[model samples]
Target chain A: MDKPLNCTIKNPVNLTLGDIKVDMLCGCKVVDITFPNIMSPEVGEIRFKNFYVATLTVKAKYRTENTPRHTGDQPKWKTCLKRVKLMPDPHSEAGSHDYISLTSRQFRCELSNITGLRLILHQPSPVWREFKLEELRLFRSAGGPKTSPLPTWLLEEPKAKVQKKTVQRVASSTPKGGEGGVPDLDGLSANLQQLWALAEEVSTSQTSQSLGRFEVDGCYDINLLAYT
Target chain B: MAAERRKAIPSTSDDNKPLDSDKQFLERTNVNAVVRDVLGKIIANRPEDPVTFLADYFEALVEEQSSLVQRALRVITMTHHSRPVFEVNVRDSYNLLSKHKVNKKLKGVNGSVYTELLQALCRNLPSSVTIKLVQKLECFEHEAVPYDVFRSSIFACCVLREYAFIAEQLFASLDIQKIGKADKALCDAVMDQLKTALGSSRNDVRRIIESSYNLAPEGLHQALERALSREQTQGVCTSEHFITEACDSFLAKVKKLK
Candidate 1:
């Protein structure tokens, strides 16, 4: 028996409301999970060589407040997959564990084709309101006589794509007066100078309070935002 | 000099009156402060039975200050422990208020304090209590009560398996047209509950469905008929059962009325 291929989501994978960017009250959606060894051998084929079953064991700890105030100490877990088909494992009859086996071709195809896994937090018990992803392990086993260690090739972690920023350099030279360049003021006419002088005189006179002054009253003025 | 001296002397008239006495004057003068003070004390002390204490305090306030009472009630009911007491207090207050038409007096308060009380009471109250509240609520016209409040009360009754109460009190008495206009979700919820009740083999389902036929709006009757027919066609319903007979009789009655 080959030791199961295990993948761990980096700890504290906080589920968030995508638009508001706030922590989810009850559920999480894990997307783009790629298991290295389980890739289709052929480009479009849905079959995987020696694929049997994947056991996902999640050890989750919920937020303290998630437990109902009435129920003391005993925190009930009501977390479940929203879309994934999970069945009770017949092999492990002793312990209570959720299992999903790719025993059939359709199930294997579904598993291979899914883009993401969504987990929903159900009701009755409020204990599943918020939970921390403590440990997540996926164990893959092929039907065999002897157990072997999970292949190192399948354990290679996916690399995160880093964004590269490109810097733009400004042009080296400044243009002299020409098309799309600064206008030259040296060629001003006498009539234009007279008009400019008059405009400057009016601006100066306006700043000196040549306009009539109106009496300002403080009473009955309302600040709309003030409650009083 | 005399005017200045008179201004210098602080008015002791406000001090002479009992705190709750001259409620109208006090409310006009410092209603917010009084409300805050009362709320502060209630929150700080965390009484053994806050709902009753708050209700008593609210009653002391003049009717003009009913909003403050509503606020206090909202606060008390929001907590987990005070729910049972809140239900009892609400029932008493609703009865008293209904006798005097308090919801009408506080019409400016938006659906009145009765609506708020109903909404709060419906949140996880026992079906028995919910039925009583719904009956009391029926005193007001369908337009006066908020659709959500009415829906929640109905939903509570349904959840408690009091389908008969829903059929007789709500479905029969409510303005089906207004409910349809105001909140289609509520109408759908009612229909769903009715269907669920009708599908069951419980001894009461027959009685409940028959009563529903008597009180159900035309649209609801039609919906029920369609649902029953669908179930019948699928061979899921046996003719010997009460549901089939009830459906046939209801459809016949509806056709006769038309």
Candidate 2:
């Protein structure tokens, strides 16, 4: 991987934007957004994941005086706002938004790796006007259904001899999901059970690999050899 | 014992021959593995014609092994090792993928292959090659170059120090409001470098100051004012006199333009 894959949640998540404050000025402006932490009951801690979609239900109206002049040609006035953009970073490309009229217009956006959402309002007319945001919501889809749990190989004893046995157990097991389930001590000989217990103990005790020997002189020799 | 030994010797010999041939065939045909190995070699040797050899070898698999293009690109970038050869490989693979419509499979920000390609170029290739790559990227109508990649190129210019003018040009081209928090930090870092360059060397301070002004005009003015005030407090006539003079002239010009 070029960089570490972002930590993600396996379940769908949502955030309500009722209390967040938005600051705006006359002419073209932007709305400020605040994102809340998504807590998982299963993980028993706060889980942070990028949102997949943002839905904004807003009520806004353009001042009639700010409307564009109607020339003999087509009326240049925009009944709806133009260039409505939603983005996480101030610099990134604005996510998708649909242009609609003044009463309860819903704007949906698909964005990834965003901490907060910012709204950019582009109005052609140079008139000062106020825009109201009635509601906003953020949603994230589950990372697909949880697959079968991680293989037992990762939890196996790390000793070379026991590792070989663990691989054999994993490979010989059928896809039926019960072959590696419970070790039947009732069927196994006492000696085999003792051996298995010993292997597990050895594997768990060593948690990591031993640091290998190092020789500064050997490294110096190799460096010198490269020049030669 | 003698019969067993006789059987083992022939069996071992037969196994070794087939294994070697099978390994050779796989190495020659497996497009992903071959591309990865070639990328590694390019980093080490920087061959002249990186794309041609791979292109010819995978002429048949070009259509079949289309999925491997992302992997190949990932290998090039993830290794954090780059060369002219790797740059060509990345461009050629990107083209091939686009031709086959394999890029449709990519998702989200990761799908910005143009940005990834440019990032690799900025990190690995020479300044001239990176400049050319950026030019090529700008010409594409469908692909909008990511600001992170642009920021990285600017950072690369600062590190190279020879291409300060390119950094200036980049700062001027970008929209100030579109600069992200990370991008803002990079802008500040580059400006700091420019300030150091101005104070120490007899280089053209006008261009550097102009670029900084273009990047953040108000910020630059505030910084200059702060620096001038700080200098006054110190009560020392240092070499910073010329920088202050240059800033004054640039600020005056900006006022005239307004």
Best prediction by TM-score: 2
Error of 1 at A5 (Å): 63
lDDT per residue (tens digit) for residues A47-157 in model 2 = 122121122222122223332353444322222223433323323323323222221122222233233334444333323133323323223432221222443333322
Instruction: State how far residue A102 of model 1 sits from its true place (Å).
Output: 44
Residue by residue across B1-258, what tens digits does model 1's lDDT show? 654565566556756763333444556689768789778757754666988867766765646555543554444443333234434333433444444343545432224445555555455544444444454333233234333343333223222222222222342222233332212233333335444433333355344334333222332333433343344322222212222222222122111000
What is the TM-score of candidate 1? 0.17
> Per-residue lDDT of B58-131 in model 2, one digit per residue for the tens?
55445654344454444344222234343454444444434333256743222344445444545543444454
For model 2, the stretches where C-alpha displacement exceeds 4 angstroms are A1-228, B1-9, B12-69, B75-82, B100-258
What pairs collide in candidate 2?
A: none
True contacts kept of each: 0.00, 0.00
DockQ of all predictions against the true structure, Cα-based:
0.01, 0.00
* lDDT for model 2: 0.34
